[model samples]
Target: MWGSAGIVKPGLERINRLLSFLGHPQRNYLSIQITGTNGKGSTAVLLHNLLNAGGFRPGLFTSPHLVSPEERIRVSGRVYPGQLEKEVRDLGKRFLRRHPSFRKDPPTFFELVTGLALKHFSEEGVEVAVLETGLGGRLDAVTASEPRIVVLTTVSLDHQEFLGANLEEILLEKVAPDRGGCLVAGEVPQYLIRLILMRKRKVGGDLFTTGRDLFVWRNGKGSFDFSVRGEIIEGVSPVKGTGFQAGNALLALAAFSCVAGSVSGKRGERLLKVLEETVIPGRFEVVPGHTTVVLDVGHNLEAVKAFCREAGKLECRGRRVLVFSLMKNRDPLSLLRTWGEVADDIIYVELGEMFHPFRRIREVSSLLGVKVLVAKSLRDALSRGKKIAGSGGCVMVVGSHYLVGEYYRLEGKTADI
Candidate 1:
């Protein structure tokens, strides 16, 4: 639904209708609903791992799949087959036939997918389902499921066209799904922290914010330690990403600690084991080979900055090349400037007419600090980037998720690792 050019009809009405028709499968399992400008996918995966370790049959649903639509739904950390999606589609068609009013006003693609995931989870006998909101909190389809724990990861200025124009407005839109439940918030901008707390106060939920109610810090040697109230889980293996991931890990751990009630002995061991094993694809994911490659689906300015910062941390023997393409609506000037500071070479590929034109980039390429080069396609860009990087260097693919999806499709890669 994210990569498509479909207009977002933000509301719970359609999804609610679909869920009701499906017999409210979401009610059959405990759930954690996560929403944020960034890190939602990674956090959802982490929480799913924790739930698995806690001996629950966890179902994870993330958005903007890298390779297949089925990637959006996973039971016990494994994606459903394409046929399952087909079955869900056929079921929807059958329902529409019975209710001509539904045919007159059909559910959106995301709503259908959300219904599919919930129904699948119910059929799979999931004990808990971790759902990452497809959009802002309140109106997103995932909200229809009604999670017991609601998590808000780092909130930033993105999706202004739909969410809001400024951070405060966007924060309101994100915190609307609190439902006066176990609301956990990650490290948001300092200014928004107070606003989130204020919202929690008004909404009357048990507010748990990182650095306030919960704390996580590096324990040296690429390990982390987190504490909630008085309990502590020490020596958690670092997540496979930039330093920012520690915050995401902490957010997940905090939410899981609430669900599981304690993180000690066997439970602590499970947490540690899951942390070391989980590798979220397209989130600063590194694939090692002749020429090292990094894939990241960071569309907004904050995400781009984090991607560049992580790319800078890599030990590159030769050139550090960046291959990227941004949506037409995004202002690439600042993003380009940030990446230019670290990248030795930058290659721009045109995905379609929907993306920002390479010619538009060429117009201000001189003004930008990076050495910009245009490629005929993603394959061409990756090839040039690998050549520029040589065997000893690195090629980092960043910007939109669509760009990363395009690369995976062209290269026949499922983004394992």
Candidate 2:
């Protein structure tokens, strides 16, 4: 049983090394590499849904599954645990034997998991797979897959230590090496476009604005009336979360257009209806408990911004209680400051299961300008958060998907949190 700590690292070197020894299984199925600071999960979901609707067997690979690792690899919205495990075992056995050099490093957790996904997707004969990057762009395990289509959902300043100091540098590392046509949410940094042209000798991957291309203006009944467009065609997202979900939906629309030829406006409409009905648990998910609780995996500035913006719009008249934790690399102070203005009281807790340390939990939340409570653990935080919500107000738990996954683990689920 190789566990998480032994498996994680800086880049694709381990996977690349492992795959080269095993004969590169990632190339077997067409995969679109989805890279960005935010929206990777939702974009991957949209990509998976669109391809499945187009009569294609598509696999979706994402991280920190809201409920289970089974959520990480899906074909046509169905998770195949038995099939996934078989592929993982086969690949794990072979890769370990074949890559003696990488064995010293042990192919960090994400790299091993990615290898498992590639093997599963390949063995399943999936027509396509959406590979959402774990962190940063360059040297990530997904880069070893060398996708045919590179999709940038959006880039913002996050992951400062490994991804570089500024947006331009981050964009260069993320988008420059992209070999194929890109599909981006409109208006990436000017420098990123320049680098893409420099590398591929081409231009144009930008779609329309998030609000324009995939809009959720409002329905009279308090639900959202939304539409997502790509290449002059529009699809509706039935499952609504926040306005930023539009960006992810539109990213999917562009991906579908780029690969499958535009969806027949009629098929697309039906697809849109199907999409609107999608339920990705824990992502802006409003769970009906004793009090209303919204769970999100917003680990960075841009993601936190989107979640807080949407959280502010909720019609609940009660106090807004926030239970939060973040990774060491995230902008915790800045994120908490932003959440501070919107949330009524903040409950800070540690995510013990991640690569980060526990003290960072208190350090970051201390920067907030409001009343902050420190919980010994996630369960304690949830108990306190619920008490603060007190049968009336809204309780929001957010931070990293690691935090969300940790929550799922405490809830007694069968899969990886």
CA lDDT, every model vs. true structure: 0.82, 0.70
- Clash pairs of candidate 2? 7-108, 7-109, 8-108, 8-109, 237-276, 238-276, 239-276, 405-417
Give model 1's TM-score versus the native structure.
0.94
Q: What does each candidate score in C-alpha RMSD?
A: 2.2, 3.8
For model 2, residues 169-268, the per-residue Cα lDDT tens digits are 8876777436655545434666665554565555444433344454444555533444445334333434563454655665677677767765546766
Q: Estimate candidate 1's alpha-carbon lDDT, on a 0 to 1 scale.
A: 0.82
Candidate whose TM-score is highest? 1
Lowest summed lDDT window (length 10), candidate 1 = 1-10
- In candidate 2, clashing pairs total 8
Give lDDT tens digits, candidate 1, residues 189-239.
788998877777877868888778888887776777878756788877646
Off by over 4 Å in 2: 1-8, 83-93, 185-187, 190-238, 353-368, 410-417
Model 2 gets an lDDT of: 0.70
For candidate 2, the TM-score is 0.84
